[model samples]
Target chain A: MNSQDAILPIAIPLAGAGVAMLLRGWPKAQRLWTFGILMASLAMCANLLNHVFSSGKPLVFQLGGWAAPFGISIVVDALSAIMIVMVQFVMLMGCIYALDAKDIAKRYSVFMPLFLTLTVGLTGVMLTGDTFNLFVFMELIVISAAALTAMSDDRSGTEAAFKYFYISQLATIFLLLANGLIYMSYGTLNMADLAIRIKTDALAGGPMPPMFTLAMVCFFATFMIKCAAFPFHFWQPDFHAAAPTAVSAMLSSVVVKSGVYGFIRMTTLLFEPFAPQLQQVLMLIGAIGVIYGGFSAFGTHHAKRMFAYSTLAQIGFMLMGIGWGGTLGIAAAIVFMVNHALIKSAMLMLSGYLASKAQIKSASFENIKGLGKYLPQSGVLFFIGSMALAGLPPLNGFVSKMMVFRAGIEAEQWAWLAAIGLASLLTLIYTMRAFQWVWFVPPAAGVKAKKDGDSLFAPTMLILACVVLGIWGESLVSIAMQASEWVQQPAAYIAAVNPAK
Target chain B: MDIIISFAIAVLFATGIYQLLRRNVVRSALGLVIISNAINLFLLAIGAYDGTVQSYAKAIGVRSDALPLALILTAIVISMGGFAFTFAMLYIVMRRYKTADIDAITELKN
Candidate 1:
């Protein structure tokens, strides 16, 4: 495939968002247009992934024909390609579920356009090879996602949106400061160029400026807040809980992955010399997130809130895997990231579906108690999703979790391993407890189920993916290995971006 | 010049943080705006001023970098959009709750 094709995934959604906005007068046309755009982008991503893997090189597109280190470069390596495909796939599912959920469709005329814009932002974030471009794309994501969250039917949605918007701005400000610091010291905003400069400087035995470490700290704090790790996770549960069901699924599944992506890019590409040290810190913070998120999730009674806390815990698991800091460890983290994205999105959508069927249209246990009995299909789906989330056998979560466990063992990180084990036990306890309460508990008096006609196709498709990936997980593991190897050795990525060097 | 710019940035940051910690939602929003401006100034300072030449005119002598100007402009635009959205949301929130106090806006809980 041509290197120019790399921009299609980002450009298509962006242009399509404009078109979707115009078609807003016709909801039917808007839905079709949005769906068509997502499918086209997904195809483009798949094609790009195939090209990158087959050629064994990153696909680099220099914007406006300007060379790297001077102009914007859009690079699609194996890791970025994998992440793009996963995110677009999840977005497509969320769109499908949103279309089927009548309340959202009826209330929000701008949903389709906003959703398309969000995809554009996400794809741009995944593709951009420049730090400044990453910041720009991140802003795009924050704006669209905050708007989507504000459009939730719940009155609390606006409050959640405000909180999300304000906190995200704070994070981005830190990011901007970090970017400025990097540019000041290295004289380049292009990631590949910065990587080369840092490497060369280290080889020359030069002392790094203290500003560099401060920049790293800023980067660390920005991503941790974005990732909703411990101590910075206060905004997540309320934000996720207040968002619309499909939006909630998207937020928990792929949106938060942007933070994880930043960490990966930082540790793997920008600050390679500092990785070993950062990995230890990441492990410590991740372990704390695991315990805190798990216990908080168990303590919560709201369905969406519980899942949000669980998201914190799952992100912690991926962080610990990343902290293991070898080819195997990064691969396991990739596996876990992909698996958790699918399983968590499915669980969120299922919860949304059940909430839609309830009289009060809330995911709180009090409103949704015994509601699953009326929707046995969703009940089965939720069971599979929960089991998968808890890393049960014959599910994708189990395979990824096993990989993470293996990575920890190989790394000989016994203390972190114990933390992971305890977190796993906690995950099991919380998920099963929520499962029992929702599916088995008797309905409290005066709680009645509504005759909602929302389709279960979205969550079902995701759950089916979980089962399929679980059964045939070797392929995913191999792909994760390939991606991780590309990540570990940045030479190819740097060369692809700056061929002249 | 470096000391002056650093002092300015420090002062702006302190004021921004103070406003940000206020109980009033509007003040906090304005705090964000102030902080963003401070960051923009910091970006400018990081470029290390060279007043010998203009950005538009490139001479054989020392030329000042224009990239920081571009970066600051971008930051200004983004922060402006963010503030506009934040104010609009605050207006809605205020109208709904009839208060600008953040502590009173407690609709969402665990």
Candidate 2:
């Protein structure tokens, strides 16, 4: 649990990606190499999580042997550790599931390279302790995502990529504006350093300049848009629906969490002092996201599009949960992140598989039907995913959703509670309709159902994971509580990154 | 000088947003280019450039901070890559769809 261990998560995938680029002519070799790299990385993530949990402290790694505040550091507390493990886990599953998604894998020789780079960027965002570095990582993510979105052969893929590119650039512009203001005020870009300086400056009886609040507002708005929250969420649906199925899985499941990760990290590191006031705002945004995403999703018919909107609704729930503003709220948000990442990746991959095997190569329930009889096991797994998404009882989603409800109640936000309740009902209705369309109905006139081999492994593992999270909910809850505590109180975080201090 | 530069940055930003809201993909891409330049200018302004110093003096007291210059250099390189990528896509989109308007690229719409 030290700085050296911190680099492993980023390095493995990056090196693998470089090697993958070299092996571009041989798809088989490329796939094998990337899979091995991801598995090794997953194991390393597990080891890091175990080590951190046992040590019960944060791991700090300063680059090039420099002092923390003087140099960039990678800090992994419980929260970061869990997110790392979760991100790596989903990515590993995605790699396996994507073997059959040949349209994307075979088309772009740089696909795996870009995929590894995306993972590196995500890990960087989660683990880095510098604001400017966060900007750099955000750029990496945007560039890779835009390229991947455009990699698909469909004409609309280019358009979707462009749309996402411009919108995300707007968000990045706001982020840079905030970072410039912060550097101007504090003369430091290290997050922990800023936290300490801001606090000490406040304690010396100098109220923060109004400019600081404006900078934080910039960070807030940018991260909210990145989260694809209610008002600025229009960019995600097209990108998610149009990307190749494997990329769609990654975009819907793991990529969007970078925004949530940034919001949580920035809040814990920079805005804990303003949590009480900010909590209400967070709840309000979360609630709006829930209802709007829910009702809108209810009207969507295409399978991937439906899932994309559902993801919107799910993020809304996550925001409301975290906005409740305490150990429970933060823990619930963390749980929601983990659960959504698992279920959505599986669901997207499954839909991709079904649609690819069908005659029409589309995910509209209109194009393919009776998927249940052709792939009964997949149908059951899909049902599990839908049920979990809708927060059906005795499932993983239920546990997190219930925690969110309890957290909302504790915060005494009856309106948030009511909105969330209605959102949940909307989710159930749409999800069930989706389930009926895919699994229960007779085959579409021209549809043909063929099950593919080894494609089921990833979804099965992910669905099993959902079950484990439910049956073993206590462990997740306890870990989430500990993680939330570590996040809420940033003293250890600051100290770990700047141990010499 | 600072006031002038700030005013110009504001104008650049205004123009960028206007272009970004255009219906044509090519124009929107042009908007992105303008906005990126404005962003670089804002970063430079935040560094509080000291114009009195001679540009070639290596050991001057009034020189501006070098960090924003480095940052702008990096930002320029990165944005060039991004813009190049977007423009290539724009070309492909134009050739494939025979139009530059995003509204007409509706094959994926529900």
Candidate 3:
């Protein structure tokens, strides 16, 4: 891709963000501005997706016409295009949901700009040829997340945001440190350049330095925190439950995926240096996260908190595919990642509607009873979303879940496959319980207002999206497969790194 | 030069651990800022501080290491934004609940 094309998708949102930030006081006008920005993003992403689908190779653009390795470059391969597409879809839905909110104008004004900036950062991370630029974008996303999380004036919101900010900042530092070490060793932060140097020099004589292992370990830890894996997930429930619904969707969908994206990019591009061990470590962590998150979700009563725990479990399934280390497994992982992003964002939005009707933002199971009778549409929407999350057959979730399980079997990891099944069952238990209590059980008479304003407007769209995605998942899977092909063949990425070749 | 890096890491680690263990939200946030700085220093050191100019010196028959500098500069700005966020959080907590201790404010349920 030429610099003009590569720069537009990133620049359009960034310029929008600049304008939105400047126009903060006019909350009423902010929605129009955000709508415009999201539409532009959607268009650009669609154009990029079309271009890639027609053209078999990845699009490479060196900024300012500078050559790779010496100067910064951006490459939009299949994975980049797919991720951009997913971000654009969820973000568009998020803006629509926010626009329906009445008192949230000021919040929307602040959030829209940050949201745009975060998009630029995430897309930039995925497309950038340089590893160090990945760090820059990652920081942008992290900082924006911190600000977004704390934007809520509530007690739990601020507290959760602070915890998330602290741990994530620590994770960023570790990432930066790892990037520095890799640069010191290779003298270039371009991933393809590093791969080539590692291939040529290490293949000839020298033992692969311990630096490779340490750097991978540091990188692993950083992403593990970002993904909210089993041990480092203390902040997940708090942040997910405390933040506003739209923000929660962003956290679950785009922000968390940033970490998974990093792990996939690193393992695919840099794993050759320490190939075998990295895969093994990833598999071990993935398997553990699967079991741990599922079982933990089983015990949670709060609606959104349970969903947060479930998010960790789903991430586990995606990571398992990457760890299994083959074209098929990686493809399965990519499909699952995209599927989760769609469904989970929708689930958060629906949860918001349920909370608003109850006149309490709390998502406790007991508080959710008989909402189905009062608001039939949101109740049904939540049920469908819950089913998709449980990996029920024919839904998008089931297909991706099946792919991950198949990948495990293909790799001959029978025990992990069993764990995956057990996790699926656990998912069913929690999601069914949440659905039953929220939709079926009768609420205590006169506890609160049973009906409310059109708060369900935003959440309903998310539910509609979830249903459509569940029914028509094959189209998404096909795109994921195309992305997997590019990931499997690193030539496009390599060309971006070493254009002379 | 090495001492500077070590001191920064030590201070950051100490402050981070202290704040992490505290009940006060503001203190914890301050500790996070300190730790983020330490991490940036460590990254700068690992990227190789040539004890001269920070750049790769591309103009003087030598190229400045733009990659590390760009990343660190970005990191610095991000931390500053985070710092501002922490202050905002503190203000919210103070205004709403009149408490800076995270444990004291428990209105929102999990």
lDDT against the true structure, per candidate, is 0.90, 0.83, 0.76
| Model 2: docking quality category | medium
The deviation in Å at residue A266 for candidate 2 is: 2.7
TM-score of 2: 0.95
Residue-level lDDT of model 3, residues A186-300, one tens digit each, is 7777778887887786678777666766776888888889888777888888888777777788888878888788778877776565666777877888888889998888898
Give the candidates in order of TM-score, highest first: 1, 2, 3
Instruction: Let me know the DockQ for model 1.
Output: 0.82
| Candidate 2 residue pairs in clash (backbone atoms < 3 Å) | A3-A61
Runs with alpha carbons beyond 4 Å of true place in candidate 2: A203-207, A450-454, B51-64
Candidate 1 C-alpha error for residue A231, in Å: 1.1
Better of 1 and 3 by TM-score: 1
TM-score of model 3 vs. true structure: 0.91
Off by over 4 Å in 1: B48-60
Which residue segments of model 3 deviate by more than 4 Å? A102-108, A447-451, A454-462, B1-30, B43-71, B91-109
Looking at model 3, residue B77 earns an lDDT score of 83
Question: Model 1 - which docking category?
Answer: high
- Considering only chain B, report the TM-score of model 3: 0.77
TM-score of each: 0.98, 0.95, 0.91
Q: With candidate 2 superimposed using the best TM-score fit, by how many Å does residue A243's alpha carbon deviate from the native?
A: 0.9
State the lDDT of candidate 1 residue by residue for B1-110, as single tens digits: 88999999999999999999999999999999999989999999987467678645757666678888889999989888988999999999999999999889988975
